[model samples]
Target: MTDPLALRHEHAFDIRINFDKRWSTGPVYGGASIGYTSIGEGSTVEGPMLTGTLVDYSGADWPVVRADGVVELNAHYMIRAEDGALIYIRNLGYVHRPLRTKGQGPDEEPDVPAYFRCTPYFKAPEDGPHAWLNRTVIVGVGQRQPKVTAEDPPDHSLFRYYAIR
Candidate 1:
């Protein structure tokens, strides 16, 4: 038993999911994919990374809801960089609801503010300048947006990622 790993981090980038679409396959029990967990269609992301902008999105989000009202989300997507480099990202995280009491239901959490956090894994070109993304440990903080007016969508959110050093 030796010393524990020292933790240090820096802000990496942020992904703004401006437009979102979703449909659930229904939650299945006793499996990795489970109920009422909505699947996100290819939502668009607009952000800069390593001086490049993420231009395209192609993938889906697989989510599972636990009895305790926690949402496990696995988002797998491919993004095209402005420089023509394609990068793959998989963000696995959870949306935490208010702790439920005995006999309470998941809907009871609707009034409580939710907490969302996730760790993102990346796959980038080995020899590319941004190749460092392949080995860095990253964590993301999520901020959800509720519809403000008639023109605003409810599915929008921004996930800011940070690289742990």
Candidate 2:
């Protein structure tokens, strides 16, 4: 028998935000984010992701609502090396944050909170050149930096992603 762990390797990925649009309904804050990924090492797979976040602010003080968060992420990837083969990914996770304000103001700063971690499930064509992702389990770690400005439709949270071995 062979060691299964010995055959697996960890790869890191860099995520850059394209945009995030956030809104609030009563005490619930929710938003959608779109971004791209830069794969690590020699992988030619790169793509965009759309994520949705919901923050509950009913238990905090006025103005500055601090609470736990949950998010849903959906990604579509293209393999540049394999003539642009497509891959799909889905991720769901929780966010841990400190007491922070939502928007920027004269006396308030943007919420720069803690990191969020998630497990990503990949789906790829079995016959595709990069089909190995379909059978692999990947863990993702992310950092959040929420931005608020005076402009209309200010940029929201920015996140970076790293894949765990």
Candidate 3:
């Protein structure tokens, strides 16, 4: 018997992103994000890893800061490939989770549930060494950590992504 679950274990690389405080007048969760992305997957044969910037926005049902459920996010990226090549990525996905607490001891409140999952499509220059990424499909799993506070709404959010091949 073939184990379908085992077949899905195609491991790729992981990504860690940091945002520079989101600004929006529309609403709390209604805004765009422009930040830096680092290659958390470590080094390969290449001299050094590439870094890039990201532009992302929330969908209609955004600002779900207080809501406990799934929220949608759309993003566009321009990244430098490992070989100093350029690659663009488009993402369509959602984060399903709840708010969090700094800590949860035996007597403390329960921890908030948070998880990020998305599908990213890559586009590479036809003549670049990373052109192969143009045809590869990638799925990402991440964790969301929204700032915890009393007066401050969810302003800062961080995510860590793991690629699935």
Q: Pick the candidate with the highest lDDT.
A: 1
Model 1 lDDT-worst window of ten = 35-44
At residue 13, what lDDT does model 3 achieve? 51
Candidate 3 residue-wise lDDT, 83-141, digit = tens:
56656667667776554465556575557656677786777788756665566656667
The best-first sequence of candidates by TM-score reads 1, 3, 2
Model with the higher TM-score, candidate 1 or 3: 1
Clash pairs detected, candidate 1: 27-34, 27-35, 27-36, 28-34
Candidate 3 segments whose C-alpha is farther than 4 A from its true place = 1-9, 25-69, 98-113, 146-165
**Strongest candidate by TM-score:** 1
Tell me the spans in candidate 1 whose CA falls farther than 4 Å from its real position.
1-4, 30-57, 101-113
Query: Alpha-carbon error at 64 in model 2, in Å?
Result: 18
lDDT of 2: 0.42
Q: Cα lDDT of all candidates, in order? A: 0.69, 0.42, 0.48
- If the candidates were sorted by their lDDT against the true structure, best first, what order would they fall in? 1, 3, 2
- The pairs that clash in candidate 3 are none
CA error at residue 153 for candidate 3, angstroms: 19
Better of 2 and 3 by TM-score: 3
- Badly placed stretches (over 4 Å) of model 2 are 1-9, 27-82, 99-113, 147-165
